[model samples]
Target: MLKAMSGKMCSSSSILQAQKLVDQLQIEACMERFKISLTAADLVRYCQGHRRSDPLITGISSSSNPFKDKKTCVLL
Candidate 1:
């Protein structure tokens, strides 16, 4: 299965199809941990300029001051 789904040989559409099959097989819970691994890999690729934007990266970058405290918190 991995051979047929090799990254070098498969397009995004094929990968999506494979993911759907995996979902139907009810192994998504096992695959859940891989979501972070895949996101990290994509983030590394994005930082290296090998790929384009990801929502996770974009949301972090676009925030003006994510760490800022609220005015109410300051008065407390």
Candidate 2:
């Protein structure tokens, strides 16, 4: 294959190198897109997990009632 650049002849090796660079750029772009998709999925999963585990009853612990554990003290 023959290619002209600025009225200059390009060698086959140079064309091959250019093709390699193009392929590498495409691969990088695909990887970046994949990473973004994975991150979005992870965020959704986290949101669902948090929402699912959220208790409907707020602060129902037995320790919340101070009078429940009251002790009578005898003074000398």
Find the candidate with the highest TM-score and give its number.
2
Relative to the true structure, candidate 1 reaches a TM of 0.26
Clashes of each: 0, 0
lDDT of 1 by residue, 1-76 (tens): 4344444766677788978998877875655565878899988877778335544555544345667554544454
lDDT (tens digit, per residue) of candidate 2 on 37-64: 8899999898777775554434445666
Model 1 has an lDDT value of 0.65
Best by lDDT: 2
Note the residue pairs that clash in candidate 2: none
| Cα-based TM-score, every candidate | 0.26, 0.37
